[model samples]
Target: MSPTIRSLVIPVTDLAAAKAVYTALLGAPHTDESYYVGYNVDGFEVSLNPSGDTAGPVAFADVDDLDAARESLLAAGATEQSAPRKVAPEARVCVLADGDGNPIGLRGR
Candidate 1:
């Protein structure tokens, strides 16, 4: 199994239209809301957000220990982009910028 989230959060302008296209490819979403839509494709997550950031896709890595993972990445030269935020009852997420400033997300319990 992949240790990473295998998750991609795409920014879209037209949520409805984008949802249509993605739904056709990945089928129904498990979590559908106006701001975000999420689908699980064989354990891989493909999420869509209709925010006009235009920053492109962000990938998240699933970690058992978010704090440890964040510390490890920080020690390895990654800079924190966003602090951990709880999105669900069992999930929390944060973003870190790699050497090139690319966003890397960490998701965990």
Candidate 2:
């Protein structure tokens, strides 16, 4: 299954500050903003989640076959963090970390 980037979530301590930076970086006013803001850009979605802890980004994607995708990653030297699990009617996903410990997600509807 060929995967495509779906969303990128950035945890932020100050939503307004982060929004300003990202808005300028993207060079466009936010497409959507609320207490929880979401931006749909270039077939990739950007979202900001508020938190007090240090921020980090999470990359999400679409996969035709999540199970097969996970297997392929393992074969290619990725370590599984969580086995695939259903998220109910909406979708399913699995978690893995590459050799460098960056998270990689496998997801399907």
Candidate 3:
């Protein structure tokens, strides 16, 4: 199964400041912010995670089969940051680092 990027959780230190910037950039306030600030713009869902020292960009993708996706990524030379683990009752997530230490999170049920 191929993976499709479903959402991106950008780590931002300043929630208020970043919200304002994103609001201007997206032309509206985030659609959802109570649980986690999320802005749906141009067919992309940008989620703002209120923690982390994210120095750069990160990508999160959704896969139909998490095990297969993880295997493919490993075969493609990605290094595991975290093995697949259930974060919810019916879902699992994993993370890997690419050649340049860029993180990519994988999610599936």
The lDDT values for all models are 0.88, 0.73, 0.77
The alpha-carbon deviation from the true structure for residue 91 of candidate 1, after best TM-score superposition, in angstroms, is 0.7
Error of 3 at 68 (Å): 2.4
Error of 3 at 72 (Å): 2.6
TM-score of 1: 0.86
For residues 1-109, what per-residue lDDT tens digits would candidate 2 score against the true structure? 4588797767788888888888777755455555456776886778776752222576867898787788888999999866787854878866788898787866785
Tens digits of per-residue lDDT, candidate 3, 10-103, equal: 7787778877887778766455564357778777778776664355445778888889888998999999987888856987977888898889
Off by over 4 Å in 3: 29-35, 83-91
Pitting candidate 1 against candidate 3, the one with the higher lDDT is 1
lDDT of 1 by residue, 60-97 (tens): 89998889899999999999977988988998888899
Model 2 spans > 4 angstroms off: 23-36, 51-55, 81-89
TM-score of each: 0.86, 0.61, 0.74
Instruction: Identify the superior model by TM-score, candidate 1 or candidate 3.
Output: 1
Name the best candidate (by lDDT): 1
Quantify how close model 2 is to the true structure by its C-alpha RMSD in Å: 4.0
